[model samples]
Target: MNVSINIKWPLIILLMLPFTLAIGCLIQIKHFAPEPLILKKDEIFTLPSGTNYAGLEKLLRRQHLAKKTCWLPWLIKLEPKLAEVKAGTYRLQPGMTVRDLLNLLVSGKEAQFSIQFIEGERLKEWLTVLSRAPYMKHDLHDVTPQTLGVKLGDPADSILEGEFYPDTYLYTATTSDSAILKRARQRMKLMLLKIWEGRAEGLPYETPQELLIMASIVEKETAIKEERARVASVFINRLRAGMKLQTDPTVIYGISEDYHNSITRRDLMTPTPYNTYIINGLPPTPIAMPGQASLKAAAHPEESEYLYFVADGRGGHVFSTNLASHNQAVRKYRQGHDIRGNNE
Candidate 1:
């Protein structure tokens, strides 16, 4: 009987050994799961592509985010979902626990970044903004106006100015520059189509492109919300009367990179496709990006006989129906500057 009891006791001890170790590991995991990590502030963590659970564990240990412990491996083994971590940039907040971090990694919600394309800015300026943005992939190294226009199904010689909408766009890390530009372009197209369909009747514009050109001019003319429609009316009246749309913004755009801060007489007289002083109608292309308000104003201009406008020396403009009145207003505000009837 004593020998039999001794053999039974040994068997019982062997059976209980794994259970005891498992209980100890469970206690360690519970303790580590809720404890705050050793982070003082927000931290940006990047998990490289093709990284697995074991690799992440090693990285956590190396970064001192987690203590070197054997129980972590046991926790991972118990929760198989923890092994599935998505590769992307993540922002880890303070007081986050191991469980929270694991959930975030497996959820695949990467940190988002934003880039803004502003109104009245040129495409070159927008490209510069994209190039300086953080975490963006510079895929536009060989991009030009001609190549980009062709890629967007426009003619190879098509001008890409004012084709993209000016707005803030959000994207994940490593988003290509071309991707953002394409989205902006699509948005602009949709918005332009919508506005063109709802355009007011009897406007001088023959095509949506011509309306876009006028909108770009209005956007550059006055930032005042009330003045946009009035400004559009002036250009439309000029187009109807066969008079020159003598705007300074077009002259500046014609001068291109060589334009100084102020427009000179030489720039006004120089013959270029964009120089409204020389051109009889709208410029061949838009000078800058136009926002929704300007586009809408171009589509639906105010009913007015104003043929000219000059800066009021304030933030607004003085509109006139005749060149004599326009010259008088220009002389009143401009004082000693050129006696040009249009806003310079």
Candidate 2:
């Protein structure tokens, strides 16, 4: 039996038309069934934190921001990266494809407002600026230095003050208040770890944690880079001799708003643990986020017996070993230049 060129091939092909159309219809439904209303640049999706994929899809579809929220899971099942979308306030531009939108979410390229923490400014000013920033999810009313320690699973008094080193930070439109605090804390922890790993021998601080605490005090005492080591040394000597640290920053740190600003001679007498004149040891916690230099100072103090330090009207302080020499140095160098006597 020989096979002939199939004269029934045309009929077989014709019979398959209905099946082909059915498959086409099924695909159309599977891929793009519900068309979404177009979105413009002015259109905004105020996405909240903790939004799961299913919750987000329904919301987007309802607002006409998505073509079919139902298909999101299936698409992610094909490409699992889609489910890893970050939560942020997303502004939609008109005519953006679903794929493009998903790519933005996966990349976490959300819109942000910038907040800069400047050097020399105290924590009060820093907190004020941060509280007014946009997209913050935390309550500023509850963001005192004392409160931060509590959030970190410590007692209210255990939190460090004024020590979050000044630096630039990036934040999303609706980042929580605690999240921002967490970032500053994380920075402090990182700097301490790095400095501790490379510390100098013969320093007084035994552990990285103690070093950080002392550095926090030194950081608040002086912003001058060259003076940091000497300032650190004074505290070290005080610690060795069983004397009060008597540092101004610590007293200022313990005081409330009225007490922190415009510190007076009497403020030092306040019966607070942070008032180093009264407290014999380190404060309950780190005073602030100490910078690398301050941390280094804590680790590598100057080899001097200087028991006295006074601001020299410049950005630095003058150090001396004895009262007569310190007074003489003060007369020669700091005369007529508005020097403030740091009560030791």
Candidate 3:
């Protein structure tokens, strides 16, 4: 025998009511979940030091990154340490969420700005470039080189030129120009000390400063890496042989603010502190910034009898031990010949 029972629709509905309510609540929570912000472009967000949760909310509001302004204040209630944010410029991504942005700020991952001080650049040119770097804080306007040295804690009474190390320097947006220069200056000092300590014995250079001056000349002489030591050797040989350096770059440096073209015979005859033709030794100051290769070459120059070199039309140079051979190489290069001089 089969038995039949009748169930009311209202009873079934009543039983499903609690589950229905629970599903609706879940749907609401999912709707309010954190999501990527809608930004057309990435921006730099700055959270100053000691910013509290409320301050962060205001900043986020201005940046259009905040979805729910109350979320952070409540979040700080849960994780109190999140309230302590570091001060820095941060690269806020286009799709970054409030959570992601907050995490980055709390993590102290600041945006980095870089400035490259190229080798062989004059100190004045370097300063001009540094002053124009975007987002870099500057205080060097109208500051004399002497005052700059004092600000950088240098006790030397002489002017600081070619004293800054040539390298790519990383800094924060708020980093002062003076601070970057100070680090470069310190780096150069350390490098000079280290190189001087291990310099070749019997080098004619009486001091590290002289080595720097010669290194600057070598840096300006050639851009080819393999030629640095060779060029430095020629200068050293000339110094030892009691010959005037007679380098064109040194002569040009002597002309200073007046130099703008090929060296003239009159310029060679002119006497200045930096004129190697008139002065039988290294210039009183470095003519340009020397890189590590040049510095190392100056400190540990190759042993060679080469006393002269000229541009070989190509990037490399033609070295010669005698005036006749040097003149011949210069003529060959001027004629655009690919002749590798016998001195090589």
Candidate 4:
């Protein structure tokens, strides 16, 4: 009986603990917790494109991000105006909660944007693309290779045309042309070095830079993707045989004062440093930003004595050892396709 009178404060405390925690959870759930996690795109994303909320949720469900979005629908219902959340480009962090992400969606917030540049694009084309970079307010069209912080020798020198590497580059829209151009040059150097490391031996090229020149030719020759290696081989064959590559693209490149797309035979015959038809060896530089595939093709050309090639016009090419076979292939493949051969 005396023992029964003893105080059970520990048990009483234990019983009240659940209630206290429950109340604390309720208070947190109601109004005491953080509003939302601040997602800084400038700091988080390295690439230009990525996921939205639902997409993020789906991805998170697969463990890309942390969980806690199970009650997302209910949480969104907590703030009906939040349900009107506008999807926007953001730099979301890892472990963002449903409620936190909801607030970010409801609030328009951006510090930067992701931008991409594909291979085979012209440098002039990049001006338009950079002009539209998010958070960037200034016009980059006027900025050239010299003004962009990247030192390419002379002031009027614009050797960066086809030198910009192909890849996903990270930059805030507020990033300067100088920074961008420097980054681009670095990327190009990195890419060239990588291609050089894997270059095939016994090729006619003296250096990787020369290989880039050949790659540009391969890129411009046939749009047929599978023909790159062979096309590169044909150019290499010409270089090795002391024969002029006679590539029209190089001629077109020469007279392209304003970056014209096509050229006439007269343009090919016209004397210029870039016209392979009128000169010998590779062009002074690359005509376009050759992709990795094109670079690889240039590094490792398909072995052949055939110094001639003509477009099949069906996303392919016909290789030939001489003009007769090349002409036959042209008639069968090219039909009315011009640029077969000058001697023919």
CA lDDT for candidate 4: 0.68
* Model 4 lDDT per residue over 244-284, tens place: 98888777777877446656666767898987887878888
Give a tens-digit lDDT track for model 1, residues 32-56: 7776777999887889999977788
Error of 2 at 304 (Å): 2.6
Candidates' C-alpha lDDT: 0.88, 0.73, 0.83, 0.68
TM-score of each: 0.88, 0.62, 0.83, 0.64
Stretches of candidate 4 off by over 4 Å are 1-112, 137-141, 145-158, 257-262, 334-344
- TM-score-wise, the better of 3 and 4 is 3
Compare the candidates by TM-score and give the number of the best one. 1
Candidates 2 and 4 compared by TM-score, better number: 4
Pairs that clash in candidate 1:
none
Tens digit per residue, CA lDDT, model 2, 33-105: 2343367565555666787777767877778777656767666666677778887776567766677677777
Which residue pairs in candidate 4 collide?
41-91, 48-114
lDDT of 1 at 278: 88
The superposed Cα distance between candidate 4 and the true structure at residue 32, in angstroms, equals 8.3
Candidate 2 local distance difference test against the native: 0.73
User: What TM-score would candidate 1 get against the native?
Assistant: 0.88
